[model samples]
Target chain A: MADIQLERVRKMFGKVLAVADVSLHIKEGEFMVLLGPSGCGKTTLLRCLAGLERVDGGQVIIGGDDVTDHPPGKRGIGMVFQSYAVFPHMTVFDNIAFGLQMQRVSSAEIQRRVGEGAELLQIQQLLARYPAQLSGGQRQRVAVARAIVMRPRVLLMDEPLSNLDALLRLQMRGELKRLHHEVRSTTVYVTHDQVEALSLGDRIAVMKDGTIVQLDIPDRVYDLPATRFVGSFIGSPPMNFLEGTIRSSNGARALETAGVRLEFHGVPARGRDAVLIGIRPEHIAVERVAVAGGIPAGAIPAAVVVVEPIGPQKLLTVQVGPSTLKVTTPVDFAVDQGQRVWLRFDPSRIRLMDPQTGDAIAS
Target chain B: MTVAEQRLEQTLPPVRRQAVDWLPYVLLLPTVVFLAVFFVYPMLQAFVLSFRSPEGAITLRYFQAMLKDTYFAGALRNSFLLTAIIIPLQVVLALVIALLINTRFQGHPWFLFICAIPLGISDLGAGLIWSSFFTERGYLNLILQNLGLINEPITFLSFERPAWLYGAIVATEVWRATAIVMVILVAGLQLIPKDYFETADVFGASSWRKLRYVTLPLLRPALQTALIIRTILAFQLFATVIVMAGRIVPVLAGEAYFQYGLLRNVNIASAYAVLIMTLSMTITIFYLWLLRTKEEELGRG
Candidate 1:
C-alpha cells in the first residue's frame, strides 16, 4: 500500500476544464472518496490519479514517485470502471489473471493468486464461467477481483456498485468495506451517491465545479457542511435554507429572519448583511398546537402541508412563513395536513451561511 | 420440448394448427420458386451438360477432354494460387484499413470514402483502371522514366514477364475487393464495445496483444464472413485477369470464358464452372470451420 499525492492536477477536454488545478493527498490505506454530483469532475479526478487521463499541468505521485507521464499499466494502480469492463472473451479466471500474466508471473503463482482473489470475492465457482454467464453482481465481483489480484499500490473505483440492484449494491458495499479492511489498499473511490461516500469513505471530499468544496469525516460533512452546495448535496431531503440578515442593535448581534429573532454567541457575523440560516430536517422539533393554547417562546409557528411515510420515519413538509421546511418525525407521530404546529430550531445545529458566496459563515 | 410448449400444442385447435404448419411454407414459396428457376434448375442443367456429351449419352468423355486440355492444370493451379495469396492479402489490408477507419480521426469519413472508391467500380472497370498504370506507356513507366530510373518504358503485361503480369493482376484484385472486406470488418469493429480495449489497456496489453487476444477473438465472425466472401469472389476472377494478363494467366473463370465464348463449347465451360464452384464451396466450408463463432462452440460445450 502506498499514499497518493496529486499536486495541482488539471485536465481539460477541449475548452472545458474537466478537472481544474486541484491538490490532494491521500494517506496510505485510507479509503478516500470523491463525492459530487454528475459532471462535477469527481470521476475526472479519479481518472487523472489512475493515469487513465493525463493531467494537463500537474504531477501525480504514487508511493513517492512521480507518475505523471506513466501509462495506466505503469502507475501501479488498478481501476474498476462503472461498466465493470470484464473481458467478455476470457473466462473469469483469465480476467483475474490478466495483469499477472502481463507481469510475467509464473503459471502456478497466477493460479494461486487468482484462486485467492476469487475466494476473497466469494466467486470461486464462477472462475470457469465467461462474463456472459455471470449476473451483474457477479460481474462486479469479477471486476473487483481482477483489480485486486494485481495488488496495485492504489485501487481506484468509479461507482463500481452503481450498476447493481439496490439490495445487491448494499451487499456489495459491505463486501467492499470488508475487502478494503482485509487488504488495506489505498483507495480512491468516485461516486455521486452520498450514502456510499458517507458509509464507505474514511474521509469524503465533496466536489463541485471541478474543485473540492469540503473534505472531512462523514459526520462533519453531514452536520457541518462548509458550503450550501455541500449541505444541499449531502442529504436526501437536503438542508433547508431560510433567508435572514445579521443585525446589531445596542451592541449585540442577532439573526432576524421569518418574523423571528434568533441569537447565537459565536457567529462571526461582522460585515455580513445578508445571511442564510441552514438547518437539517431532523434538527427541528415539531409540536402540535391545541386550540386556545399559547405558542411556546422561541418557537416558529408553522402548518404541516404534507406527510410522507419513509420507513420508520415520516417526512413532514411544513409551511413556515413564505418558506418551506422538511422535518423527519417518528412514524407514530400522527400529524394531519394544514395542522398548526410550533417548530423550534436547534440553535447549536443552525449554520449561518453567506448568501452571496454560498459558503458557511464560521461560528 | 418443454412441458409448456407441449401443453400449448395440445391446446391449439386442429384447424389453426394446420394453418400454422402451412404458413411458413406459404411464406417460403416465392424464394423457393425463385431459386429453382434462376439457380437450382440452371445448376442442374450445367451439371448434366458437364457430364453428358451432345448426344446425351451421360459418359465421362467431356470430363476426360477437359482434363486433357493443355490449360486445365495451369488454370486449376492459378485459381488456387490466386485465392491462396489474394484472400490473406485482402483480409490483412482490409483489417488495417478497417482499424484505421474505426479510429474515426478528423476527416476519417473522407478517408473511408477515398478507400472505398473502388467498391463502386465494376471488376472490368477496375482492371482497366489499373491496366492504364501498368501498361508499357502507362503512368508508372512514364513516372519512372521522368524520375530517371529507367531509360526505356518497361513491359508489364506482356507474355515475356508472367511474374510481372501476375503481380499486376493480384494488385488490381486486392485493390478492388478489399473495400467490401473492410466494410464488413468496420461493421464488426463497431459491434465490439469499447470497454474491452480500455480493460486491456488497464491490464498492460500492448496494441499487438490487444489485437491478438481481445480484437481477433471477438472479430472471428466478421473475419470468417470476409474470408468466405473474398475467397468465393477470388475463384471467379475473370474480367480482371482477362483485361490485365490476357492469355498469360490461366484462371478457372478465364478458362471457362475461353471455352464458352471463344471455342463455343458449353460442355467444357460447364465443367470449368463446376470445378470453380466445387473449389469455392470447399474453401468456404474450410473457412467456416476454421473460424466458427464462440457461441457455436459454447453451445456444443
Candidate 2:
C-alpha cells in the first residue's frame, strides 16, 4: 500500500560493511523479491526496509515520508521470519490479534480482522490451536496471517518457505503468490531460492556482494542475464562458462576456448583479448549424428562423461577437451556414458561475457 | 495402550518382558536408597524429636516450649520478613542481570563471570566478605570519612542500630544467592529462540511490550525454578545472619542453632528445624502452582 525507497543505504556490522551503498525503489502494491545466495545481503536489505535494522547512511522513504528515524512499529511494516516466529504460548487467534491489540482496536474489529486473516491463510480451523500443535507449513501460514492481519503498509517475508519440506515449500510458494494477489500489499520478499523469486516476484532484484547486480522481470533475467554471475547464478546446474577470447578473422567474429568454437554474427566484434562464452544447459541442444557421418558446422563433437536421469529430462555431462558441459535432453534421447555426440550452440542464444567484469558484453 | 504396543507386548517373550519391567526399579534403587538414608531418615528423626517429650512418650511439649520461647516469635517474624522482601527483590535483580547478560553486551562473558563469581563463594565466605563492608572500621565507613560525608566512622553493625544490621545482613544474603538465581535465569533466557524477539520487533512491539508479551510467558518455568530454590534458602537464613547481624537477629535457622549449640536442647533445635522445613516446603509448592508449565505446551516445541 506504500512505495518504499532506499537512497544509497549503507549498513556496517562492526568493521565489515554488510549492506554497501545501495539504492532501490519498490512501487506501491508490487511484489518485489530480493534474491541471492546465503550471506548475499538480501536479508540485510529486507531488514533495513522493515526498519528492523537502521541504515548507517541514507534515507528510507515509505509512503512519501522518511521512515529511517522511526522505530519498526511506526514504520507500518509486517514481517514473516524464516523461522515462522509464531508465538508458541499464544493460540493462532491470539497471534493474529496481537498487532490489532497493540494498536488499541476494538474487540469486535480485532475479531473481524483475525477471522479474516485466518480465512485468507486458510487457518480458520487452527484458530484455537497452539503453535506446538501445528505443522511447519501451518506455523508459517500462521506467521503470514499474523503479519497481514493488521494490514501493515508494507509486508516483508524472509525465506518463509525455506524451513518447510520440499513438497510443502512448493505448495506454500503458490499459496504465498496467491495471498499477495489477494492482499495486494506492497511486499519485499527475500530468498536465496531462484525458482521462488522467479515464480513469485513481479520483478526480481538479483543481488551479490551487498548490491543489486540485476533487476528485471523473470523472463528477461533468464533469457538475457545482465551479468555472467546472474546468468550462472539463476540456473540449476548453473550456466556453463567456456573461457575464450574473441577472434577476429577477416571481420568474422568467433569465440574460441577449450576445444569449443562459437562463430557469432550481427553483434559487432569488440577487440578483446579475453571473453567468456556463456550458455545454459537447457539452451544447449544435443544433435543426433549418423554413425559414420562427419560432425556438422556450428556443432562441436564431444564425448559424454555421465548421463544423469532427473525426472523426464536427462542431464548429460559431455567432455569438451579438459572442460565439461551439462546438456539437458529428453529421457529417451538414446545417450549413454562415453557416447559421442555433437553439441550445438546457436550463436544468438550464446552470451558474450567480459571475463574481468563478470558481466555480459552489451551488443 | 495403542494396538501396536499391545501387539508388541504379546510378541515379547515372557522372560524378557519380566526383566524389562524390573529394569526401571533396578535403575532407580541407588537414588531411592540414597534419599531414604540421607533425607527421609533425618526428616523422620526431626519429626519424632519435635513431637516427643524427654519422658520418651509421644507429646507436643517441645513444640509448646518452642512456641513459648522468648526468641521464637522474633525468629518467626524475622524469617518471614526476610523471605517476603528477598523473594521479589532477588527475582527482579537476578532477572535483570540475566537479561543484561543475555544481550551479549560487549565483554559479556567477562561481565557474566563477574556477576556469577559469588555463586562460587560459599554462603559463609560471602557473609564474611560482606561483613568487612558493613563493619564500623570497614571500607564503607572509611569511604564515608574520606569523602568528608561524616566526621566519624558509622557503627553499621552496632546493636543500637538494629535497622542497619538488618540492612547489612539482607544485602549480604541477596548478593550471595542472587547469582545462583541469575545463572538459572540466564540458562532459561538462552533456551528461548532469538526468532521470537525478532518477530516481536518486526510486529512493532516496543522493548517493554516484547518483555511482557514474549519473554515473561516463555520464562515461566525458569522463574518458577529460581523462585522455589531462593525461597527455600531464604527460610533457612543462617550463615549470612550469623556473620553480618550475629545474635542481634533471631532468624529460624539461627534459633535452631542457638537451641542446639548454646541451650544444648536437641528437642527444641529439631522443632525449629522442622518448622523451617515445613515453611520452605509450603512456599516451594506455592511457587510451583503459581508458575506451573502445562504439559501440552511442551508437546512438539
Candidate 3:
C-alpha cells in the first residue's frame, strides 16, 4: 500500500473548471472518502488520482514517486466503478484473473490467485457464471474481487455501492471495510451519501464547488464543522441555520432573530454583526410542555408544525418564531401538530457562522 | 394459464383479461400479412418458374442446362470470390472506422458524417463514382501521369487482366458497404458501457487487449447482424459489378439478368435467383452460428 498525495491538482473540461486546486494527502492504508453532491467535482478529483483524467496542473505522488505523467495502467492502481463494470463477456473467474492475464502471469498462478480471491469473496461456486447471471450484490463482489486480485498499491472506488439496494449497500459497505482491513490498501472512495462517508471513511473530505470545505474524522466533521456549508451538508435532517444579528451587551452576547433571542455562552464573536447559528436536529430535545422554572438553558419556545413518526424515532418540525427547526426525539416522546413545545438547544452544539461569507466565526 | 384465468375471473372482470389475451395476436397480424404477401408468395412463384419448360411440363432440364452453361462456373467462382474477399475486407475496414469514431476526437461529427456519406449513395452510383478514378482516361491516370508515376494510362478494368478488374470491383464494394458495417458497429460500441474500458485501463491493458477482451465480444450481436444484411446484399451484386466491370465479370446476379432480359430464358434466370437466395441463406446461417451469443453472455440473462 502507498500513500497518495495530490498537490494542488486542477482539471478543466473545455470552458468548465471541474476540479480547482484540490490538494489532499491520504495516509497509507487509510480509507479516504470524498463526499459531495452531484457536480461537486468529488468524482473528478478521484479520477485525477486514477489517471483516468489528466490534471491541468500539479503533481500526483504515489509512494513518494511522482506519477503525474503516468498512464492509468502504468500507475499500478485498481478501481471499482460505480456501475460495477464487470466484463460481461467473461466468467467471474476470468474477470478476476484479467489483470494477471494482462501482466502475462503464468496459468497456474492465475488459477491459484483467482481461486483464492473467489474463496475470500465466498464466490467460488460462481466462478463459471457470467456477470449477467449474478445479482447486484454478487456483481459488486466480483468487481471487488477483480480489483483486489491485482493487489495494486491503491484502490479507487467511485460510488461503487450506489447501485445496490439499501440492504445490499449496507452489506457491501461492511464487505468493503472488511476487505480493506484484510488487505490494507490505501483506498479513495467517492460518494454523495453522508452516512456511507461517516460509517466507512477513516477521514471524510466534505467537498463543495470543487473545493474541500472540511477534511476531518467523521465525528469531528459532524460535531465541529469548519463552515456553514459543512454544517448544513453533513448531517441527516441537516443542521438548521437561523439568521440573526449578534447583539453584545455588557460582556454578554445574544443572537437576536425575528421573535427569539438566543443567549449564547462560551462563544467568542469576531467582528460579525450578522450571524447564522447552526444546530443539529438530533441535538435538540423537544419538551412536552414549557415548564415555569425547569426550562433548560438556551430554550426556545416553539409551536409544533408537523410530527412525523419515522420508524423507531420521531422527527419534530417545530417553528421557533419565524424559523423552522427540526428536532429528533424518541418514539415514546409524544408531541402533536399545533401543540406548544419548548426546544432545548445544546449550547455546546451551536456553531456560529458568518451570514455574508458563509465562513464559520471562530473565537 | 387456464387455471390462472379461472382464478383471475374470481377477482377481475373477464373483458379486460380477454382484451389483454387478444392484444398479442392483433399486434402480430400486420407482420404475418406483410411476410406472406411479400415473401412466401414470391418464393413459391420462383420455385414454380425454375422447374417449368416451354411446353408447360415440370422438368429439371433448365437446371441441368443452366449448370452446364459456359458462363456458369466462371460466374459462380467470381461471385463467391468477391464475397469471400469483400466481406472480410469490409469487416476489418468497418471495425477500424468504428473504433476511430469511438475515439470521439475533435471534429468527430464531421468525420462520422463523411464516413457515412457512402451509405447515402446506391451501389450502382458508388460503382460509377469509383470508375471515374479507375478508368484509363480518368482522374487516377491523369494524377499518376502528372506525378510521373507512370508513362501511360493503365487498363484497370480490362477483361485481359482479370485480377485488376477484380481489384476494381472489390475496392468499389468495400467503399460502398464498409460504412453500413461501421454504422452498425458504432451503434454496438455505444451500447457498451464506457466503464468497462476504464476498468481495462486500470488493469494495464493496452489498446489491443481492450479491443479483444472488451469490445469484440460485446459487439458480436451487431457484427452478426451487419454480416447477415451485407452478405445477403452482396449475393445480389449485380448493379455495381455491371456498372464497373460489366461482362468482364460474370457474376451470379448478372448471369441471372443476362438469362432473363437478354437470353429470354426465364427458367434459367429463376434457377440462378434460387441459387442466390440459397447461398445468401447459407452464409447468413453460418454467420449467425459463428457469432452466436448465449443468453447469459449478453449481460441481461
TM-score of each: 0.91, 0.90, 0.93
Q: Which ten residues in a row have the lowest lDDT in candidate 1 chain B?
A: B292-301
Q: What digit string (tens of lDDT, one per residue) describes model 1 on residues B30-116?
A: 999999999999889889989986686887777788899999999999988988888889999999999988889999999989998
DockQ values, each candidate: 0.40, 0.48, 0.64
Candidate 2, residue B116: Cα displacement in angstroms equals 3.2
- Tens digits of per-residue lDDT, candidate 2, B1-301, equal 9999999999987774333578889999999999999999999999999987778888888989999999999999999998888878888999999999998989999998998898889989988998998788899999999999999888788789988888888788888889999999999999999888877877777788889999999898898888888888898888888988777888999999999999998999999999999998888888888887655555553
Point out the higher-scoring one by DockQ: 1 or 2.
2
Candidate 2 displacement at residue A101 in angstroms: 2.1
Measured with C-alpha atoms, the lDDT of residue B153 in candidate 3 is: 95
Candidate 3 C-alpha lDDT tens digits along B145-164: 99999998998878888888
Q: Which ten residues in a row have the lowest lDDT in candidate 1 chain A?
A: A262-271
Q: What proportion of the true contacts does each candidate reproduce?
A: 0.39, 0.59, 0.80
Residue A297 deviation, candidate 1, in Å? 2.1
Which candidate achieves the best TM-score against the true structure?
Answer: 3
* TM-score sort, best first: 3, 1, 2
- DockQ of model 3, rounded to 2 decimals: 0.64
lDDT of 1 by residue, A164-214 (tens): 999999999999999999999999999999999999999999998898899
Docking class of 3: medium
Give the Å shift of residue B257 in candidate 2: 1.4
Residue A65 in model 3: shift from native, Å? 1.4
